[model samples]
Target: MLSEKSMELSRKIIILIYGRAFSFILSLIIPLVLTRLLVKDDYGSYQQLIMIYAIVQAILLFGMPQSLLYYFPRKEISDRSLLIKQTWSILAISGLLVITLFGITSQTMESIFPDHHLQPFIFLLGIYIGIMLSVMPLQNLLILEDKETTAMWSMICFTVIDIIILPSAAWYNPTTLGMVHGIILTSIIKFVIVIFYIYKNYLSKLETRESYYQEQLAYGIPVGLTAMIYVININIDKYMVGLFFSSSVFAVYYLGSLWAPMFGWITQSASQVVIPRMSKAHNNNDLLQIRELYANSVEKLAFIFLPATVLLALIAKPLILTLFTDNYEDTVPIFSIYLLLLPTYALNLGWILMASGQTKFLLRLAMFMSIINIILSYGFLTTLEGDNRLLGIPFATVAVTWISTIVVMYKSLNTLESTLSESYHWKKMVTIGAISALSAIPIIALLSLELENKIFLISSIVIYGITFLFTSFKFNILNDNEINLVKSFLPFKN
Candidate 1:
């Protein structure tokens, strides 16, 4: 029988998944519209701008949002107000510091992206970052309040607004700067909503706690810095690509290099489902539960990820051409290379490390991986030319990610008092992956026939879907209980 906590976790995962699915749909449509409406260079510049925000926001939040999950449950009801207030105070101060730093460093920053006129945008960027940073703690507060559904709705609203605004903004002004304005406007609107919600729900209940800030800072800074390193690891390739190729070329690579949303959404949703439970289990020193959750999560994630990875890799060319048009045909190989890393993301070690308060280890791992990425990216850029140079980054990424995954697994296993074999079954993982890959063979054969590009893509997806589902169920890739859990959320059951 499932425990109440397990049932609640399932419910939250369901809510978050539905929210992410809707957001993902909007996400797909937005890129389609913007990639076509904006020029290639403009799209590339927009991507770079977003990368900048990602790095800055990751740094500025400093992982304080994570602390809420750790600290909130321990506090008394009256003490909650103090925690909320202190968190907001710290975020505001950090946001101000970031804005001032950016204003002072605008010229030096401008030199990095030579083609873009960043001088004017620097001030706007600072404001945008400031507003975003200030709102993050409050946003996390919602999750702590068990209002993840509310937070998810806010995300959906913003995405809806983005879809309506971004392409129209690009169409009207038809420039990178104009799209920047659209981004800023959308952010401002979202920021206002967050502020209002935070104030109404949390601020009114606030009280003073001089020591709470110190506690949150101690816990949050390392996590934040670690996250910053992660940002660098993922994004250094973009800088390398931009430096070597034109903005137009960078745009093509960027589109190709996007993480598959199916994998991302599943990983993210699973993390959300497991982290709090894992944290509670760790707090109680229940190694047994930790090991159980860890094993179950990897198995479930592998079941979904292995199949999707194989399917995407098989149909990369048709998928790229159909979605981004023939001009993006070069993206096919890069996309395929990125797909190879999908399995690495199946590891849920970060959640475990965070739950165990081993964030400094994550920081160290991120540093090691980031350095490796930079060195390899540089080597590739110097040694190779054209699209091969872009492909090299993801190749390097897959290697580094695997290395990091192994180290994390070894370290985490020692801490949990479990062997690798006990935590997750290697034989099962390999078997599942092999089975999923073999299932794609018939679909690949069909793709060789001459057909309309869109028709071919659709037919390939439909054929693969039916084949994989029938084979997987017949083989019980996911067992009966797992199958029923998934079906509970769907509208219809077979």
Candidate 2:
């Protein structure tokens, strides 16, 4: 299984698995720690600022680095120097443009949204943008060259920095501003490490690859634009929520929305490997291999995500109650609602569109959905805001995701054989999930009775996991390859 091609892909997948799992652990732990150390308003304020930070970082990326990832792997090592230079040039220009725009609208940007505490918001988020620009080149190299160890280590450095800074900074006055400063320092340290690696390992011996640069830009721009618009389309609600509702309400929704990326992150890292592999499959004109890969991806996705959806549905209240303070319990329903879309993420056919050069159609679909999403979220969140309508955002979010999934499925089916059993595997997974979900509810109800949070969460997770495993095994939903794929990642296998 670990041939040159398979070996490279497998190593990258392992790296991505490590990265995704560690990042998820970091997110869960950091928020839990900070939630304890900080006041509700302070944590809420910090969450709001990160929302803006996410969009700004997206701007710095501007879809350029990903383009670099696609074409970089195709070029010769001799031309790498020029490729590195041109890629940086593109990033530099885009970064400057983003900074310039920020400079002009800094005050408006800060005042435009009062979701967070007003003091030094621009500086706080500026650090995030800088981190994005400074990290992108290294990130590209990691994916294209399949340097998992280096990439994971680089991220580990930042996670360690964050772990140290959070508690220490809390002792040093623990304000939202202090939290921001700690984050900035961590990003700076990480950016330095990434730059050192890129220069020593990649940039120092770089040869020019201008032709590939242009090709990359052409392929990457549309996808990046699609991503940018998709970002707005997806989270435009958070941006607009501040306009229409209270910062505190946005805070509740924000806490709920934090659950959004957990499943997406898992799928995303897998897609990083799968996209390049699938692209190679296309290049080789291996239809059989390509079809098998797609089907296997779906199966693996269901294996991972089906349980998440069921678990989240069963235990959002306990999970939040245990991990966060009492202030966040109200947002529990939003997490439950968000879990409804977990499968869409694990069923990651959309990445196929972006990676396979169908980004324009994807972009169009994104724009149409964004408009619909913004409308639904604004329409609903406005009505529900003060009256405990926190569920509105997730409802709208799930709607958009399911719609996008359906559209993508249709498009993907068009690319396959007419007699293909594309829906059969999906149907089986859903059927098994329905049974798993049903069995989990009694446990969920029992756990809900205790409200003590931690114990209930632990018990719920254990029962739900065992139940899911039994159901999956019984239904034959997991074939040999999928089971083996999972076993390879676990710590110890029988």
Best by TM-score: 1
Q: Over the stretch 365-446, how does candidate 2's per-residue lDDT look in tens digits?
A: 8888988898888788668745555557668868987898888877766654423474336676667668667768768577
**Residue 156 CA displacement from its true place in model 1, Å:** 1.6
- Candidate 1 off by > 4 Å: 1-7, 107-116, 137-140, 261-263, 490-494
lDDT of 2 at 356: 60
Q: Which candidate is the best by lDDT?
A: 1
Candidate 2: which stretches are off by over 4 Å?
A: 1-15, 107-119, 208-212, 382-388, 416-424, 438-451, 478-494
lDDT of 2 at 412: 65
Model 1 lDDT on a 0 to 1 scale: 0.77
**Clashing residue pairs for model 1:** none
